[model samples]
Target: MNKKFDILAIGAHPDDVELGCGGTLAKLISEGKTCAILDLTRGELGTRGTDQTRKEEATDAAKILGIAERENLGLKDGFLVNSEEYQLEIVRMIRKYRPEIVLANAIDDRHPDHAKAAKLVSDSCFLAGLRKIETSMDGINQEVWRPKQIFHYIQWKNIVPEFVIDISEYLDVKLKACAAYKTQFYDPDSKEPVTPIATKDFFESLTYRAQDLGRLSGVAYAEGFTSEKLVAMKNFDGIVL
Candidate 1:
């Protein structure tokens, strides 16, 4: 199998990626960049929908965004920890994908698992580059691979983005992808018990949050992210919005 991807995004759960970088991923895919999602958990503890339903929803959302691949790690929801076992799992994936850039869950968030998963992925990225910490898959020896950069997407909390991407052209497409998870998001007809994120306000907030970020960046719509290291651009011409 080819061990390469333009981008690999890791989130604590299925919908987290859709809520955070759906527009960015859509734009990249439209530009012919290969992208994939690696959800740490199946979101089994969510208030709405079973793990099976969420898997289907995530599949539909990935198709809507035209992503090249989507997969879940099957970690226990709400119980993700920064441990050796988890780090090894992530390291294996990092080597498997060999992405140039990785987008991970926020460093801090309302969901505790998000932060834990972020640290695990970040650590695994560094470990993946070390020839000593070996990791493999499918009985085959995997090459040590590390992404050039890792950017953490902002969600649930406003941590002041290190940078925001102008995704104005793909904002509507992002909403379409998010709405693909009908079993998890706002669905008035669904009889499932509502969670904090299942309310109508949650859906509206997705739009307003992007709008707010866009207003600051002087774009119609944008997505925010915080990076541990500042971005080094080869040329500044026309890149900043």
Candidate 2:
């Protein structure tokens, strides 16, 4: 696989990435870095959207974020497990994309699938680097590949972030990307069953949450994430002043 990505954002569902780290992704893509999205499921179990609609919505969201590529692993929604079968599927994607950085789901969240997918993706990243764990795609053998680092995005739970990325200029883009999932989020006109995220307040919370994180970190808006391992900085040159 010659298509290498600078970052691969993995989520349990279609909208999880948009909710958790859309602005951060948009910022990276704007800077000319290639990014991709790996959705573990089609979100078929979501209350308001069908699998077909979520797929369409995901496509629109990917376009809004200027993603280099997007893929769905077709895993069963709401039944995710950290099994070898699942890990091998993820390993194939990791080897295919060869991302240097990976953005994963929160360590713990309101949705059980979020936490399940987090561990699944994290373990797969390590497994992908092992030469013995072989994976193939489209009849081609894959080389071992591992991300240099992983950062878990904040989700439904307010688990404190280890670091925050300033996204003051990209918050609107983030909101837009999340909004692309019309059925999954707020819409007064929709007659479909109202879900937790479909409320007007939940829609507003997106902005406020980013603003709150930004306030704490001294930026207008930001996205928070926790590193899986301790990160070392070579110098203070890249530190935000």
Candidate 3:
């Protein structure tokens, strides 16, 4: 197997990618589509675990999900901005990975960083295609590269999804990947102070949410996503869910 990836999922913090689209990613990788993850921050501000622990957990989750690569940009936790500096950094990654499709954070979510990171990634995808942008790494100019599509994964909010991938068979895989972050999700044994996502109800809601979307789309389980531009297909038959 090659080390390069076909899809690169980006999130503002660790575990965001898994929570949002871990099943979809696992499903793709199962079919031999290479996958990678790029986390903008180490989630240092998280209530449960330290940055180092989160990084290690992310690594474990990546292995479980079979991702080709996982990287953290080390951006300041809870304080990332959409500036030229940040945009260029994202652009460089986009070019480096050269993914065919880019999965990014939701456009609107409970966390402010999600939406901001989504825009930053979306803009970088466009900027990466511009030869005049003049991006360089290690003193070598980079070639312009843009992903064919950018899909915004749904998270924390119930906005209507443009499309949904049936993840019924991969649900267990997704749950395991999410559970790798023991300090973040529901865990009765944990002594750490609980947060909204750390509650048992929140964990149950995550499953029900996928089921609800699946019910609407006539699937057993599915992950939803939104598209900034109108998505098209060869014909109606090409539509799935």
All candidates: TM-score: 0.97, 0.98, 0.95
Best by TM-score: 2
Task: Give the alpha carbon lDDT tens digit for every residue of 1-241 in model 1.
Answer: 5479999999999989889999999999998999999999999998888899999989999999998888899998999988899889999999999999999999999999988888889999999899999767988888999899999998888889988888999999899999988888888998989888889999999899999999998988899998878788878885763
For candidate 3, give the lDDT of residue 12: 99
Model 1: clashing residue pairs? Answer: none
Judge candidate 1 at residue 148 and give its lDDT: 92
Error of 1 at 195 (Å): 1.3
lDDT of 3 by residue, 92-117 (tens): 88888889999999999999999999
Overall local distance difference test of candidate 2: 0.94
Model 3 CA RMSD to the hidden true structure, in angstroms: 2.0
Q: Let me know the TM-score candidate 3 reaches against the reference structure.
A: 0.95
Q: Total clashes, candidate 2? A: 0
lDDT tens digits by residue: candidate 2, 1-241:
4478899999999999999999999999999999999999999998897999999999999999999899999999999999999999999999999999999999999999999999999999999999998778998999999999999999999999999999999999999999999999989999999888999999999999999998998889989999999989999896578
Model 1 stretches with alpha carbons more than 4 Å out: none
Clashing pairs in 3: none
**Where is model 2 poorest over a 10-residue stretch in terms of lDDT?**
232-241
